[model samples]
Target: MAQETDAPQAPPSAPTAPARALLPLILPAVVVGVTASLVFVGVSVAAERLQQVLWGPLPDALGVGRYSVLWMFAMLTATGLAVGLVVWKAPGHAGADPATFGLNSPVMAPAVVPGLVLATGLMLAGGPSLGPENPVIAVNVGLAAWLGARLLPRTPGALWPVLAESATIGALFGTPVAAALVISEALAGRPMRGRLWDNVFAPLAAGACGAMTTTLVAHPAFDLGLPPMSHHPHAKDLLTALVISSAAALLGMGAVHAFPYVHAAFRRLRHPMLMIPAGGVVLGALGALGGRLTLFKGLSEVGELARRPEGWSAGQFAAMAVVKLTALLVAASCGFRGGRIFPAVFIGTAVGLCAHALVPAVHPAVGVATGVLGMLLAITRQAWVSLFTAAVLVASPSVLALLCIASLPAWLLVTGRAQMQLREDGTPVR
Candidate 1:
């Protein structure tokens, strides 16, 4: 009684149980990594190879100019609508958008993951403009959450799944450390830090898995000559880079603003499922309208751009840019899930083509780099990220210099505009 009455000793001042209760992170992270390796790389490679074999011959048969935005639009469009329908009609449902990256919403609805993946397969098959990265990320996150809830041992040992998430994220990004950071930031609300060992290996496993898988099935995710790294810049070139990069940023910011409102307009559909799938299919068909402007995944096209920076006629490039932008917009709003990264590349390439034609002083390579820089600016709202991505893409210090120089003015133009805010996840906020 005396001991109890002494303010109950304040219950020993309380142990302060973990803010997050993730305990089983040790083995799960490894599993997540291994699974991602098998699933992601396997899916991407199988899809890519099939696409090549089936559609690869079409361009040659048609004597196409190289690639077509029209074809891309049609395929992605169909994919979007199909995905929308699957999500709507399917029993399990997960939702996606830029918000998925933020984890600001509930982990996916569980039912939707299957539909999204299936739709992604459709998109890949149809030659749409969607990227697997976004869907894969969603799938990864969803799996982590579901497993964390179900499999982890009860009695205060939920830490392992959290670690698995970190590792999986890190592996997927091709940067184990970054994946860790990404997982940390994403799980900040979840309180998952006490078990370090459990989480550390998750990313390692996932990274190894993703890397091996990528090598087995697909070409390089990113490749630029090391020699390009040696290129230096004159003051003038630096200035150009600055201007171009800035312009790219501003453009990106503006796009963030515009895409949402347009999407909103499309959102009021009484039958979003039907609308999205129909929209996707229509867009795919629309892509076909541009004649040879349609094709599936532009990886080969990107290679073509690199190979013959000087070869593409200015007019053809311009057409490609317009069609690509339209295709991406339609694909996204219509319900297909994918990142806009590669599409942005196409846009930038177009901008580069146009810029070189208009400003003959600018090298085509520099111009392409500038376009990519600007689009990243639009997407990330982070100048530094844009700069880094752009610089890395060209791998030419000289070109990067020019793009950085261009980025300033672009920032100036883009920042003040209402269109640049992303919802704090570095995605377009609007």
Candidate 2:
């Protein structure tokens, strides 16, 4: 649940480098980008394969429905034990108790990468309501920094983390624009020597290559396949967008407020062995209530929800939203190694669907997009990513203006609120 950022520090003095000097970094950036994408895709494929084994053949052979309440409970509990063993026994403890560190935390040692990767793969495969972004970024950052230092001793030590972070982000989202936006947000208010684009140059190239690599290999898609809003923006639609986005933001803030309390409860269990399996049990129960639609990191599930919105009632969507939010809280609290963004998206999609079902006038695309915008803004506290994600989910140019406007009020509600991350002492990250 740690929020991601570009971990490396910017230079203290504002001294612009010559364009030619930066040219040397481009090749390395390209390499880093492609490497990051391969790592991301590799881990994802491995996790998916494991997931198939756990949720597919094994269940069939056992003569139990893979997603039945009993099977869900058993599988999730077992997953927790497996990951708990890795965390308790593995080196670096899966890289600093995922709850305590953000993506911008200091680069980890290369020695810790294997354990982190294993734990991440397990969580992703095990159906935890978390995403691969955080630990994956940690893995890449550690590897990139350690390897980059050896290969390019003459380069600034800070450059590797930036490149790795940007590249992995591009791979994750299947677009360099996401990487560019994330890096640009990090650069804001920092003392930098060069023009903004100059500073962004190498990372941008890395992001582009990373995005291309993932697109070529995996063909990830973010659009939820909702029917496009055919009419021009109306005054009522704008008001509806604001209302839904603000409500969703407030809803997400509820989870943020509850994060520390839930995390503390797990901490009181005092061992990963106890805490994680206990979490899995709770997650299983929630999944039983919410069904399979509310499980996992939520990208594909959200797509499914959008594809057949009429199949579920408003109450069903509401229940899914609540259950997913709770599941996200418990999973992140109980020492699971993953990110919050994807689950938050699922929660948002559910909320949006609920709104559309209830009111009928709220366009599905508008409801879903603004719902995501608000939830992401509250959870990630990153404006650009929130806007980008919400916009991308609907994939409508017409919705962009509405999302941008809706985000303004939603951002206000979450701006000074406690973020959905915890400090070592279990306090919310301010």
Q: What is the C-alpha RMSD of each candidate to the true structure, in Å?
A: 7.8, 7.5
Cα deviation at 214, candidate 1, in Å, is 3.2
lDDT per residue for candidate 1 within 16-88, as digits (tens), equals 3353433333356566666665566665666776667445686557665324664455445545665676667
With candidate 1 superimposed using the best TM-score fit, by how many Å does residue 185's alpha carbon deviate from the native? 7.6
Every model's TM-score: 0.72, 0.95
Write down the lDDT that model 1 would get. Answer: 0.57
Candidate 2 deviant stretches above 4 angstroms: 1-17
Off by over 4 Å in 1: 1-28, 49-81, 94-106, 154-209, 216-219, 224-231, 289-297, 382-388, 397-430
* Clashing residue pairs found in predicted model 2: none
What lDDT does candidate 2 reach at residue 39? 99
lDDT of all predictions: 0.57, 0.90
